[model samples]
Target chain A: MYTESNEKKLDEIISHYPVKRSAILPALYIAQDEHGHVTDDDIRYLAKRLDMRVNEVEEVVTFYSMYSRKPIGKYKLQVCRTLSCMLQGAEQITEHISHKLGCEIGGTTPDGKFTLQEVECLGYCDLAPCLQVNFDYHEKISTESVDQLIDSLK
Target chain B: MTKVLTSRFDLKGEACDIDVYLKTGGYQALAKSLKELKPEQVLDEVKKSALRGRGGAGFPTGMKWSFVPKESKRPKYVVCNADESEPGTGKDRDLMRYDPHQLIEGMVIAAYCLNAKDNYIYIRGEYWYIKEILEKAIAQAYERGYLGKNVLGSGFECNLYVHPGAGAYICGEETALLESLEGKRGHPRLKPPFPAVVGLYGGPTVVNNVETLAAVPWIIINGGEAYKALGTEKSGGTKMFTVSGHVARPGNYEVPMGYPLMKLINEDCGGIPGGRKLKAVIPGGSSVPIITAEESEKVNMDYESVGTVGSMLGSGGVIVMDETTDIFETTRNVTHFYKHESCGWCTPCREGTRWLYKVFERMHRYEGRPGDVELLDDLADKILGKSFCPLGDAAAMPVQSAIKKFREDFDRRIKHTLVQINKAAD
Candidate 1:
């Protein structure tokens, strides 16, 4: 169940496409924003609203790396672990954050405040060793800066 | 020096604003095309420009446009591949973030040529900020009559919207992008009925990269010949290279096609930092073959020249690695990327990438078998061109080339494992 404002937002996005199903990705974003991660109930509601099978919505949600099927931490610390980032010492950055958070890569903090993930190229290689806290990018970051970032977030 | 694609980058944050873009001669090409040039003439200019796709493949842009059926009954679509997820590629991100209007103008010109009214820019979800910037610019374009039911008082109508992908690299492939846009899994479709013929809601479609589309307005405004004259006869026009890793100046540099690879690394990028010798370079993105510094001496940043040195000018993502870098670790890292990104659509790619990654991981952990190097080479060969899309080839090329050029690195790992095993047996 989406808020009235969110429902209005979904309606507006759906109007942009000729087919209602085309808006599923954008609609999921709204639902995720409303309910943290995509819950099973959210998928069912989206399937019914968009006139699609539940499996269809589930597959799309599961296929993409960004969408979360279950609940995640408030702060998703996604470090870029691809070629360029690695060349600039992304491994050390990931390690530093992992140490600071007291969790391994792909693990969430005990308090559910932060989750660390090793993401593929974020297209910010020019600013290598970059990471994203939620949607905000922290580029060309040093281990010290990463430490500061965690402290600030905490 | 002639920044055709990134001429407005100097405007900094203000480049995204329509007023600044207007002052700096932004949408004049769109105006020129809509008023003076016919659809065929517009297309002819692009053809004469000799521009190739900037999104890795380097296919001729004009030829791709010509593939769409001219007299199609269904609504044609012009989809901009703004999914700049190639490992080292970030030029498109800059193009869209800095000069959103340039991309919009080019898209409108393309839509006019294709007789398509509805266009979508499928950007990666990670670029949510850039999406907002693009959306704001699109709003500005709509307000100024550059888009909507009529454009700049011309009868031709166009509507442009930004569509965000939910984080899948395979979606960067044209067909996979179309599939994702249709609210499905980001699995690539079979070729033959290419996007030009049957694409985007089962209509004729033309998908061009952000950098490729951003160049269209300039090609139209300054006659195609003028644009072509800027670079090599075959390559044509300037390209933006996102030079990263080891370089003192790791930033986006817009240089003419066929610019010397060494010059970019030395003069433009300030060479490898801390006096480190350049060990290897992934001239393209992670997908292209790696070239040693010795081989890179004669290489130029063009499709043909880079090809001669056994690499591609893919997405113009020049990833430099210094002598201190270990080739084995780097290859393992890259292999893991393919393993994670593989869509599992094709059996060879789906299974091959996972197996290759597992072998690389074992080798990295010093558990490599004696024939692991040859096995990786064999696996890469099997996946090279045996998949539904280029993703498999992308996954395979880097691994294959790394083994060819840096065989010693793999051999050294296997030797270390062998020695350890012998000592244990003793």
Candidate 2:
């Protein structure tokens, strides 16, 4: 179900690289952006577009953490739970978000407004206890701030 | 002791804008390199400066460039490692955010030295915002004829692109980076055909860190000896130390190589927050050995000094722990990171990391066995140098060091658990 415009954009991405297969990562990103996750159908479309076996695209989807095999929530709250952030209460923040949303770490809220994830270091340790909501970084967050963020998201 | 690399950082009024960069003497080095010096001469100057790769390994930059085969028939490549996925490291993000064109200018010069027609900056997927900043800067560079199609009329062409990494820490490793760039999973290839010998697209390639490439402009402009005069005998030039965790001023501090570790913590970072006493420090990134708090004060922020203290000056990611910190819990957290990031290429790394994390997880829950520590030591010994890449060794180093240096913490956990079990039995 690749649109004409999407196919055009794919062409531009392919033109940037000497080898056409190098376009797979960026192509997957585009598909994920449109679909919120890569489904079997999206994988088939990408495999055909990039001229690869379906297993090749599926391997990529499984290997990297960012690509979601299942549909994700509107606001994916990826909290930094690595060393520096953990030391500064990232675990507490994750628990707080998970509790407020009535969902587990990787599960979406019942309303599907939020998905809480405990991620490794986002490399923004100076502002520890950070979380990214849909690629927008919210640094040095607290439970209270996360509460406010959830309120603001809806 | 002037601020060479970070001279324009944190300045007001569109810090990353092209006009602001130009006003602060941005492309002058690029112009000079294209107009005045030969590519070999540029390489020689970097060689003389003794700039080490800032992406953890600290290999000499000029020496790395010298490895790119001069007679290769295939198209050479220069891949800039902007992944910066190591825990406690945020300096590269700051560099890309605040001073984008500086990195671009550095990459241009580096590409020239290697005779590479095209270059790529493989950045972490999380830093999409910073990557946008870099792309804007690159567009501006091209508009001004600084990047593409015979850059600055020097009869040399250079094209630069930004590639986003899809959330894998192993891609930060040079060989894995090339694999990911080539649309494969981020598994690091075996050495002997090192990247310099056969890299991206089966061509002789040179992979350098973003921080290493960014220093090229300054080295070329001020000359190599001047840059060399900035730091210690072997470690020359200023390094961006990412001082985080338990510090008052948790931020990126660019200091000369031989800067005192205590001074950086006390003066620059305003010491530990809330006046807590220091317990220990990961003087480099989490992969390196952790130095005890007592030894950290005597440490210098250089390669040799940190190494002499039994830890390499890795990635300049200084993670400080205060008296209130729990060594056992922190070790579990660190172990968990390696276990999650191990690429599963080698059996030792894949299995060793998983078991290492499981042992720590059990201990944190007070279910540690009597010989768990010995079990850990044996597993680490088996994994140390046997894996395909450093991922296995990285998992082993900090865990091994923590158990050795802080055995009391592990003993305490086991004893507390056993006491609870006996009380329940009674």
Candidate 3:
């Protein structure tokens, strides 16, 4: 999905680290930034450029959960449900969102508007029961807040 | 001259020999522990100090040490998690490279108290230079009888080895670290049989961070009350803040717990580089949420206090961001990291991370529909707390927190990108 320009910037970043493996993390970031997910072709491109094996790149991409092997919905919703958030009632919010969006964690909605996912620690323990919609965070979440928030979506 | 937030860094050309570390008042704690205080006494002193783990999670240190079984048949073990893979943090390399003996002495003391026979420093693969330095220290330690059979002739024999990780960030996690040390995939195992009962070849193992164990030698040397006097009530002892990013004098700044973040940045770190106005900061390492400039001002570099401002004292990595930077792009960088690093052992993490990254990409491309922000918030809420490991949670935290605190910026970036696209078309 990247243009030739995006590919060039990725190549430049790959050159910073001595070991090709060290460049993998930054390379994957750049590739994913260009393409929605890192495909086999992208891994091969990076592996070849970094002088690393394609399997190595593929192994790393598969090892990390963030690499999307398939196309995902337009919007991704990550909800925090760790000890801190759970103690703050993350379960209630989880059910409300799933029911309203008609999707479960890792399940894209039928309409393709959103895909719901549960996460561990969003690190904002202060604002428990928080969810990150795209790159934004809506904190102190509840059923009503989840509905109002979800309703605002196109 | 770099500030002495790190004992080893302070020893620049200070000497790698045991004599050098000892001259700088090394092993004084062990001397105190052996000569004056008993083993349980040393442990009690740490308990009273209220020192917590320096690893990402601020689990109480003394509390973790006490987890070692009082009665166990097999040999107890102390495994140091020196695999510092958290990006934007690099203080561990400084310590290992300079003050090798300091950590060596700390491990010996820890082994003595826990009644463990062997210790392992699980250094990351990238740190060959550090590995060599530590190996030299190990050889010197053995030659001087600081290690090996009957160490210091107290009938306490402990052997220390340096183990290198192939390359896995999850190995930084304790259970996963144990798995990697055992030469297995670094996926987290089911808890309930926590590391205390069965860990590292299925024995009573106490795994600690390099910085965590390094503090032990000093703790044993000083009375618990003496260490307690240095920091605030809940968080005691000095911590290494690896300040980077916009900070001018960025490096390791050693400050006692509860040190004000503002003062540490301004007075110690010499404020931001280029005198750029402070924007936000990742108080801990990558796993902790980002705090705004105002919130960072109210923060203290401790476990409990930093939490009050919606961030953590994670690994004591202070990453400062100036106002000119974009928060969305910053978090997008972080999300991209988690997505690339998540070891798809669990469903929530594997699928969630992929989706989150995709959405960010769309937004970056000026393809976000109206109400895209709400969709992102929804996705972050869904993926957090449901994963098998902290990786998933960490991936979601910065994205959510950055967006929550700096939604306007993301909106602006999204709007600005779209405007440019339309103008180019015209």
Candidate 4:
């Protein structure tokens, strides 16, 4: 399942590091981009390409929060519930999204349109009550405007 | 008063791009170091500058660099820690977004000083855009002869690469950063073999913060003493404080060390919103102990001054709280953050943060018993010094300090709940 173009990107990433094992994280990112999420086959392919054990590759994948072992929704709404964001009413924003989507914090919507998660600081405290749909940030969002944000996502 | 690091942040033209950076005197310090100064001379200048680490600890940057052995058969490395995952810290992300080349130039100078030809920047996964910006800047630097083989024709060759992390807050730790860079799970290794001795494939390595490294170019250009003169004796140069929560103008402001904490909040940050009364302040990131508004007024934004007031100037993140802010809810939110971020490597941290959060949740839900506050303090006390890393203590200190400074507020919540229960029974 490792395409030729994916292989080229892996090679370019590996070129930067002195050891091939150091390329595992970047290679996994590329593999995840190619596939929806990291699969067993992707791990096997990465282990073979990087000359690492399958367990080593899987260990790295499982440890990180961002890498999804299972498929995620189209739009991942990662609401920052850290201290700074919390002060700016991030909890209400999170609760509103959860109630509106009819899914739990970590659950995806029935239509598979969005996956709502309460993530740690996204490092944008100035614009508190921020959440990221994929990597795009929506800052200083209110519970009132959250409906518009969800509607506009499509 | 002087803003060196962020002066170019809002400059006309493409501020982040390479051409604008070079045009506005980028890489001049690197050129100067390679042409005029020897590697030892550069190190000496940094040592004289007294610039502490901008990353949480405030360790002397020059001393950290000096720890790297002069001779090592193994390949040496310079790792720029762009993994700014701390709760109230976003200044590094700003630097990476607006001035990526400054970080590269800083790393290049550090590598030349340490004789390290290879460097990797371990950036957070969420900062994908920042990484891309850094990569673009690196490409431009290579094309411009500021980076890559025989940089500036000085025969001081160095290569810099941006390595993206996979969403682990622990990777921000230097040892954990090295482990993650080696493509392993981010677990903090023991410190006896600190990165300076055996690091990054068994070689001497120097791990500096984004702001710390970015400050190097200015320090070198302006001369060490000139940079040192900006701040207090031990804490040199201006620090970029990320002011957030309740502040009218919540953003990053680079001010000299020893700047009055209250003055920073009132003047630079436009004071608290709605002209509300100040209650508490988290002088540093959320990890440090909380300080009262009265205590904050007496303190200055420096390592020693903040410490003298019984809290640290950790990461220079000033999280202000107003009178309208509920102490119980704020403490609960903070405890929840630490509980979520615990790496699970340490038992006290893993278990203690969870327990603390549960107790806070109970208190939040009006299930607070008489001894709940004492229980909170007891749990925090147990976790403070028992953990392997600073995170456990980070979670504990804010809880402990909140109880110390705002016990009356939490007590009022518990007393009010009792009154409601009595009234219902009657």
Of candidates 4 and 3, the better by lDDT: 4
What docking tier does model 1 reach?
high
Models sorted by DockQ, best on top:
1, 2, 4, 3
Candidate 4 lDDT over A1-154, as tens digits, reads 5678887788899998878999998888887887778999999988988889999999999999889999889899999999899999998899999999999999999888899999988888877878998888888899877899898888
Error of 1 at A44 (Å): 0.9
Model number with the top DockQ: 1
The C-alpha stretches of model 2 lying farther than 4 A from their native spots are A3-5, B415-426
Candidate closest to the true structure, highest TM-score: 1
Query: By TM-score, is 1 or 4 better?
Result: 1
TM-score of chain A of each: 0.97, 0.95, 0.86, 0.94
Deviation (Å) of B156 in candidate 3: 1.4
Two-way DockQ contest, 3 vs 4, winner: 4
- C-alpha DockQ of every model: 0.92, 0.88, 0.02, 0.83
**Candidate 4, residues B382-410: lDDT per residue as tens digits?**
99989987888899999999999899767
> Which segments of model 3 are wrong by more than 4 Å?
A1-154, B1-5, B413-426
Model 1 residue runs over 4 Å out of place are B415-426
Interface quality of candidate 4 as DockQ? 0.83
Model 4 regions lying over 4 Å from their true place = B412-426
Q: Each candidate: what lDDT? A: 0.92, 0.89, 0.74, 0.89
* Structural similarity of chain A in candidate 2, as TM-score: 0.95
